[model samples]
Target: MDSHVFQAVAAAAAALLLFLTYHSLAFVAGKKLPKGTRLPPGPPGKPFVGNLFDIPPEHSWLKFKQWSDLYGPLFRLNIAGRENYVVSSEKIANDLLRERGNLYSSREQLPAAAELLGDNLRPLFLPYGSLWRRTRKLMHQLTMPSAATTYQPTQVLESTRLLDDLIRAPQDYQKWFARYSSSVIFRLGFGKTMQDEDVLRRIMDVNHSLERVASPGSYLVDTFPSLMHLPDALAPFKRELKQLHEAELGLFRELLDDVKKQMDQNVAPHCWERTFIEQQESYDLTTDQGAYVIGTLFEAGSGTTTAALQSFVLAMVHHPEWMSKIQQEVDEVVGTSRLPEFEDMPSLPTVRAVIKETMRWRPVTAGGLPHQLVKDDVYNGFFLPAGTNIHPNQWAIHREPSLYPDPEVFNPDRWLDPSFPTFKEPLTVHPNIQNYSCFGFGRRICPGQNIAERSLNILVARIAWACDISKAKDEHGNYVDVPLYDYVSGFNTHPKPFQFYLKARSPHHAIIVRSALEKETQSDPLAGK
Candidate 1:
């Protein structure tokens, strides 16, 4: 044989040996299980690659649900040698994320999400430790159920603006919703209403980028952490991610600095940012940490609230019967003399039910953020190793037929029916309900849920009370069919841009909306009178 051919064969053999040895060691290290233990059942996958190709970039929760049906409530997927345990059963989800939360509350380290998107600094993605604990404590203090009441005037004002926006340019209802949602968060977190269009655009752009990066399968570096070490020239993904991180950090810093400027002038309104800056030492947070803490609040509060309000609008357009019922309740409780207020929420159970149904009908985060196990654990005779990704599949859990009959239908009646198996009042709690799984579970449950629920309740109630939401009509005077399930897929699923016909229910309601706007514009704009 030629010397060159022999050399090439020898190099190939050496490379193969190295590959095998690395994988063998990795497998043994990950699976430090007792002899009788085994992983839960899952679909088969190819060697080396595992289920990398099987995981789609968008709407992955649907696929996970399908697998759960076939593989039973608990299943596993090996994505690029990473073990992902998906729990579709409510019982299993409760058992792991709630019952044994100490073991499963930490967040997994995603190179793209944590490092590139700068989410590692945010408590939402932080592991269960000092930083996370402090951040969460601060967030809880600001957004706890009682604390949420302090923001009622802002919510009421923004919701009234939402009503006026719908009455004026109903075609841009989605943008109006986005504006209202962002404005509320801005007021709460920064003590200022969102006035600069450019600032709003930048914040939304950052959120869109964050969503893509944080998604499970969008970045290969998340699956193959080793790739993070490659040089910029060879690993363009890393360079791009670094740029994204800088951009996000710059934005957060800019917002924080603006708040400081206001404080220096003694002109700043009461906001979370101002409070954070004042008590930074108490929270043991650096300047950067303080900025990201407030930034995370805006990021989480704005996008999710916007998506939820959009969902409520979509539900109204599709299910007019429920809309009419809710409207009737609002009219009976809050007459045309004025709009609905936060206090009216208790008397209007139907409106509250609609809010709950909207969340369940189409959850914003279909597959809740992945939780990481701090140590190897076993449940139901199955061994789940440390570092396993736990997915509490809210999409599947919310749609269980036994829990919600005709789960596909937008039925608010389920909450009102005493005979229904999982009926509960929507506004009775802060984080989640016994029947719903929208806010997530356990230690990492959304800390801003109380404020979010209040924001939704006021906006949804006011919208139902003041406007008539219906299908848009085409030039030919024919009703256009609004696709019920049309939504933009990402870490946060939102209704895609769609047309709807929104108009004041009566001239009296129109007058009330216009009067409220005029009064607010004339008096203290911040008061939202």
Candidate 2:
């Protein structure tokens, strides 16, 4: 496939390098008679291999940023005949992916993740077409900013439970954060909490596999489409990934059947799945298609929220002073009488700023999803040929010094202080992550972003109010250093396991957490904000 990301496989060994391709093949898009216009400037690469060795297996964003620094935001790379354009400037991204979305909303075919493991039905990977439009239209009612509010009752309840989880099991805060995110999305999609150990394990296993396999050059077939044309006997990646696909689809079918039975018996809780299933015929989706959409929804929310929340914790360890400031604001606004609610979100600017910063500081989709341009286009007198893969480069765009000063520092004031370029007139609207490049660009942006922000908001606020996150201590009681930018490398990257101390700010705060959980469990879980 003419690809979208780094050819990381070549970076592993005396593998093919990309520098040899730069001299004659850099900007022409295979020479279709575009004589005058030149493609975006980029690093020179090897012949045939085309920047393969130059692109690292993990943290390719850093390399992209380095090139962005040299090439001034619009740069190009060719990996084994694939044309890749990394757009580090938010303005260029908006001009192309958003404003010209008609020609740029499609995604390159990810042979491994989108085809073999996903059966080519996953909405996230689908190119812009009838199927994608149908799925997006079906989900429009459920995922919009206004609609996400309906799930606040569940979000509030689980976020309260999240506070309890941190207070009781600080060592396992990551898992609790995972659970909180999973339960919220699971309930919204399937009308049940995520309690089945086997199901959770399988979900996580598939997520990890996708992250690895979906990477640009992880599989040879993804990097070189010709390899995919061979028979299954010749292509081991196909055979193995097919089995993995069966296991994943089986999981989706199981969850769909469970929801169906509950609906048949009139016992199902209120959820998007119940609505979706009842109208599947009208939505014109096959059984498999319906399942894929719902499963994608759940998968998107769970892992991303987990990663972002974990980043919040990591940020606190890096910069504890902001933690203190946010806690003070939460205390004054939320008070000790009850857990923080979504209503308090308006009053807590520091909390919002922290969440936004956490996302900007270490975006989950670090490399940003690849958007394929469908037609030739010119931007700022620079040519971008059709079939060019564009990456918004979240890691670089968020670090744009014009918008975020001292980008390396994990500072929340950049969002609050008006002197900063990123500051908006009204604090309420400026820090929103709705259209942030970290989420995605234009029509391909994440549909579940509203729900994601709400989860981060409540959970981050409650944790800030109830617990103090600090550097962990070793056996001898010395501080354990938490690396600032060290993260697991994948399509959706997160901080690696780190040591951190989490506990209630005071005994009274711990009581408030328990009491809040008890009251929520006893009362209507869907009560108003």
Candidate 3:
């Protein structure tokens, strides 16, 4: 950790990366263009590195948006020699990523996430093809709208402890949120709760490493993929990745084997693992692939769900006015007697709007998952050659000034009130978060979208119904400030450590919350079945 030596090494690495980039640029961009077509205009980058230096060290999304404003909404950012097209306009994103998805459904090779960490088996990292299709189909069948409803009882049951955790240990609300999400995914994937502290820590660690590794520029190998070809003996850089990959797969195998043992005893609970085990042959999957499919589902849901819940808390603390409005709306729909249930979801428009607005306000994957073109394409006289990397930058797409007026402000009215341009009629249908751009676009939309939405719905509703959240206070009774942008960077992001306050709405609410946990064993009808 010598600062001077670290800086020197980093500078040298940057120089090397830049040196190889121009050569890559020559290979990728040297192809002939279609007649009467050209690439989209963008901010001019320097000779070799292109926009490498133009991008700042952190929050590159802001710089991308700034470029989108300077250039058109659909423009390119050439990093080193890579042809990255950033689509800020929702229309353009839909047109390219949705309407013409056939050609744009593939993904660029990711060194860390796709290859090193997952062996390209993780659904999120799988390119658009047969294996990707089979996995996506299986997950969709498990997590689709109607199918997602099957897990609501588990979501509701797990959330009882979440509410109790909030009432008792509000200072560790983030940990509780993490626990709630991880526990739900564990229950669904392996038919067990996340009570073992060490196992929970390992699951959390794997996901954090996943978010970190999946980030673009996390490894220079992603920039210069040749680094991935080094001999196993000489590739010291891959040691951690290899270990992480094995550890993750090992965790999945261990859990799946446990399920099999229970299955042999005829005591296994209903879970995705069991289901995959029963039907793996039909899907043409091996034993390991089955485990990975279930594990990938858990990996997809655990952290992002926690991040969404954390963002909800952040939104509540930062904008108490909107929070108050949601409280009032929830109070009117489901009185002060019991916790809000999924049945009340339809009537709680403001609550749903706040959740939608919360995600829009702060997307988990701010940078967005990069999509690759499988064939040459043209849009509006722009010749985007094959192999171009397209980023429907979630951060920029969510902040399109035309769609989200005063986008920086956390105003739920944009989704709730009729006058706002983003508002839609039939409050029951319009403000849905499942189809939001943040989830994704085209064939690559998040398979866990249904489950994430359901989890958020129940959790947000119950928390709003049972407790009040606000800024934490010191012994002197002074309120602390919550930083809006104090968020973790990477593909999947969440708030950095900050102070917050949580309390039951009243003694009655506290009683209900505590009593709910008291019935933990029999409370879930799905339990012990």
Candidate 4:
């Protein structure tokens, strides 16, 4: 053989040997570390990609149920080269989400989320650390039980507008609901009422943008994060996302700047932004922090409240009997002479049960936000590896027959026994009705739960008190049915626009509504006697 040929063969052998050596080293390292215990059940997946293509991009929740049923409560799923655990049972969810929450609080590595929002977003997305702690402190101080009382007058005023809108045009109920929710948050966050100023339009625009970006499958770059590193020429999605990122930033910053100016003038209205701005120094808050705090509160209040109201309306239309029942309760307690107040909520068991059933039947966030593990953890003898993306499929858990019998049906009776306990109480009080996962669980549970609960209760009670809700009909006058599961696909699940017929329950109710508006007119200086 020639000397040159021999040399080339030697070099090729050396390269092949190096490749094998590296592969062996990586295999041993993977074995040493615990992603999950070997022999645990998981769907058969392709090598390297690991079930990435097997799962549908949208409606991942359905896939979760299928796998959970096939593999049990705790099962392993591999994405790309990484492993994730799909937690479907309430027991496993509670164990990790609450019992051992500290280790389970960090977020999964989402490149789009990180790049777009940065750390300047809600405490919900913030890693389990100081940033989250600080934001929560500010929100808690403002939205806690006591502070919620101070905001009741605004809630009442805003809710009244909702009723007025419904009375004027019931077909626009969805928009009215959105407007009512946005107006409440605007009033609380910016200290201004949305009187024909298109609050819903502005909120819907931003929310639509957010919804587009939040879809797990919105951008293919998210699925294959390695693609994010590709050059701009090869990766057009980067430019698109960047454009969206800037647009959202501009929107948030514009709003933030107005609040900042209000602070500068020291004439800012009584709002959450003003509260945080005044104590910015004391709370160690930067402009970015304040922006996110305000942004998140607005996001939470607007989306969640709208969905809840939508659910409430949907329930009322579908089951007018419940509406009648609650209206009777409202009349019996607060009477037709006056509007129902927050204080009346405790005594109004039927109304409270209605709210519970609405939350149960159609959760705002069907699939709770994804949570990532920061470290390798073991639960019930199953190992969950570090970096494993976790989701407590709230829809599945809520629908579990074992937990809630006949979960598909909208029944308020389940929440109304003498021994039945509220979600506010732990299961030790009554194991039959575990806290609705509506507000979520663990440290990451919604901070605005108190305010949300109050706002929802008051609005629902008022609707039941004032309106007789029933299904709307087509031109042919056939009864229009609303599919219970039909909802807009987004980070938050809300029913699509649908019409409902509503009328004052009685002439007395109509008279009272007219009288309330006339009273407002009497108070206005422009109105003549």
Q: For each candidate, C-alpha RMSD in Å?
A: 4.2, 5.3, 3.6, 6.8
Model 2 lDDT tens row, 39-129: 6789997777778789998899999999999988999898877789999988888998889999999999978888888988889899989
Q: Give per-residue CA lDDT, model 3, range 158-213, as digits (tens).
A: 89889988888888888899889998889988888777888887787888888788
Off by over 4 Å in 2: 1-36, 524-529
Off by over 4 Å in 4: 1-29, 33-40, 117-122, 196-200, 418-435, 517-529
Point to the candidate with the largest TM-score. Answer: 3
TM-score of each: 0.93, 0.93, 0.94, 0.86
TM-score for candidate 1, residues paired by index: 0.93
- Candidate 1 steric clashes: 0
Question: Which residue pairs clash in candidate 1?
Answer: none
Instruction: State the displacement of the C-alpha of residue 247, model 1, in Å, after optimal TM-score superposition.
Output: 1.5
lDDT of 4 at 163: 78
- lDDT per model vs. reference: 0.83, 0.85, 0.84, 0.72
Q: Which scores better on lDDT, 2 or 4?
A: 2
Residue-pair clash count for candidate 2: 13
**lDDT value for model 1:** 0.83
Instruction: List the candidates ranked by TM-score, beginning with the highest.
Output: 3, 2, 1, 4
Residue 121 of model 2: what lDDT? 84
Query: What lDDT does candidate 1 reach at residue 352?
Result: 80
Clashes of each: 0, 13, 0, 0
Cα lDDT for residue 122, candidate 1: 67
Query: Once superposed on the true structure, which residue ranges of model 3 sit more than 4 Å away at CA?
Result: 1-22, 525-529
lDDT of each residue in 341-377, candidate 4, tens digit only: 7888767777877887888788787778877788777
Which numbered prediction scores highest in lDDT against the true structure?
2
